[model samples]
Target: MSQSVHMSVLLDEVLTALGDIKDKLVVDGTFGAGGYTRAFLEHGARVIGFDRDARVKPYVDAVSAEFPDSFQWINRPFSEMAEGLADVGVEAVDAVVLDIGVSSMQLDEAERGFSFMRDGPLDMRMSIDGRSAADIVNEDSAEDIAHVIWLYGEERKSRGIAAAIVRRRAEQKFERTLDLAEVVERALGGRRGAPVHPATRTFQGLRIAVNDELGELERALEVSEAVIKTGGVLAVVTFHSLEDRIVKNFFAERCGKLPSGSRYAPEVKAANDPTYELVTHKAQGPSDAELARNPRSRSAKLRAGRRTAAATWSEQTVSGKPSTNKVRS
Candidate 1:
C-alpha cells in the first residue's frame, strides 16, 4: 500500500494575504502542487511558477495546456528566479509567494526518500541534479553531520545521532530511510511521555543539508524583494523554527525594527532607512478551522510584508548587514 499525501498547511491564509491580482503578474516561488498558482489564476492574475524539480515538468505541462500563456512555468530554483525572469523579460511582479521547505508530495513518494516513516532510498534532493541525502549520510564526517543536524534541524541530540550514524555506516553504508532512522532511534530514545518519533529531527536535518534548503530560501527572499513592485505583497509560508526566524528577522530588518531588544535594552537606530512596511505585526498561522482539517498546518507560519513605493530591494539590510545568515554550527 502507498501513503496518502495532502498539503496540510496555510493554504487559505496564503491566498487571502495575496489578495486581488486580476490581470496582474504574480510569481509563485515554490510552485509545489500549483496551489498558490491556481489561486492567483482564479483571481484573474497571470502567474509565473518556479520550481527546481524536474518532476514539476509534467504538472507544468498540464497547467500550461489548460491556461495557455496566462501561466508560465519556469523549471528553476527560486534562488535563480531573478536570472530566469530576466531571460523571459519579466522585470517586476505584482506579488510573490513562497511556500518553503519540503512538501507532502515529495515525502509521500517512497522513492524520493523524504519521510522517515516509510522505508525508501535516502535521496532527498529537490532537484535531480544535486548530491543526495544518501550521499551525505554515507560519506560526511561525524562533526559535519552533527553540525548540520544541530543547526538546521535544531536537534538537541545531534551528537548522539551523528555518532550512531557514523558507527553504523562504518559497518555498512546507509541506503534507505528506515536504515538511517533505526540508527537515530537507537541513539536517541523517545522523550518521556512524548509521542513524537525519534528519527524526525535527524531526517529533517539530512534533508535540509542535502538540498541546501536554508541557503536557497534566503537567496530567494532577496530575489523576491528585487522583482516585486512597490505595494506588492510578499508572502512566505515556513514549516520550521529556523525558517520562521529568517522570515521574522527579514521583516524586522526591512521595517527598521531589527535593533530593538525586548525588555532588555533601548532601540538602537538602524544605520539605513526602512524598505518594507510590515503587513502583519506578528506571524500568522493556520486558523483553528484549517488546523482541524489538516494537522500538519499546526507547524506552519505565514509572514507577509508590502514593499514601499520608494524602496529598492537592495536598500533593505538584515542585521544592518547584507542578508546572509547561514549557521553551519
Candidate 2:
C-alpha cells in the first residue's frame, strides 16, 4: 500500500497532556498513519500501535524500520488493546492515547466512501470487513435508517432523508457515494446555502452505525482503565459531540464526579474510590495557527485523565444506567 498523508490532530496538546515519556511504554490506541506512534517513539518511548485498517501496513512498516526495537504494531481495534497486549506478555502501559473517528486518509480515499464529495463504492468499513454503508442504506427499513440518522447523526430531517433513500433504492439500489449524497441533498431541500453539505450528517450516521464507532469508544475507555498503570495518562481526542459526550461522562464518573440524585432523596456517596484524576478540567481545542493549517481540526476536542491507585470498578458498578444511544444491529 502506498503511503497516505495524514496530519494528527492536536499533536502538541496530546503530547503535553501525556507529559514526559522517555523510556515509558505508551500505547497509541488509534494508530492511523502512525502519527502519534512516530512521535512517541521519537521521544524515547517503546510504542505499541493498534489499528484495524489493513491499509496502514506501509506506515507500520516505515515506523518499524526506523525504530525496530521500540515499535510494535497490532492488527486489531483499540478496544481490544488489553488482549493484544496480553498476547505479547504485556500487562500495563505508562500511557494510552486515542485519536478517535475516521482518519483523513480514509476520507481522502474515494474508494473508502467516507466522503460524499468523492464518488466511489459505498463502502466505509474501517476494518474492510463486515457490513458496509451500502448495506445499511440499501437494506435497512426507512424507520431504521431514520433512527440511525437521528440518533447518530443528530440530523433533524432524518425521516425525510430515509424516506427519500427508500424511494430511490426501489428504482435502483444505492451503490455509489454520490448517489446516496444526491438523494439526501434533494430530500433536505438542496442545502439552501447551508454552511456544510446536507449529506454530511447522514454519511456520518451511516459510518458510525456501520462500524459501531461509539460502542467501540465506550469499550476502549473501559479497557483503558484496566490496561493503564496507576499514574498513567489516558488521553482521548474526539471529533464530534456524541464522542466527546461519552469521553466526558466516562471521565466524570471515573473521577468521582457523579451527579447528586434528587432533593427528596438523601445524599449518596460514590460506591467505589476514584480511579482517575482529571488531567484537564476542560477539553482542549486547537490554536488559531493550527486551525488555519488544518480546518478539519476545528471540531477536535482533547480530554485526558491520569489513573489513580484505586481498584478498577466492574462494568455494572461503573454506571447505574445502561447506554441507550447504541445503534441497533
Off by over 4 Å in 1: 1-5, 190-193, 313-329
Assess each prediction's global lDDT (C-alpha) against the native.
0.81, 0.89
> Which candidate number has the best lDDT?
2
Which tens-of-lDDT digit does each residue in 1-329 have in candidate 1?
11124453776777677777899888998877776777688779999999998886766776778789799988899999889899899888888888989887788789899998888888998988778888888888999999989998889989888898889888999898988887888788644565778888888888898889889988988887778777788999999999999888888877767656575977665555555788777889888988777787788999998876544435434344434212100
Candidate 1 global CA lDDT score? 0.81
Runs in model 2 lying further than 4 Å from the true structure? 1-4, 260-269, 315-329
Best by TM-score: 2
lDDT value, candidate 2, whole model: 0.89
lDDT of 2 by residue, 118-228 (tens): 999999999978999999998999999999999999999899999999999999998999999999999998979999999999999999999999999999998898888
Residue 84 lDDT, candidate 1, scale 0-100 = 88
TM-score of each: 0.91, 0.92
How many clashes (backbone N, Cα, C below 3 Å) per candidate?
Answer: 0, 0
Error of 1 at 70 (Å): 0.9
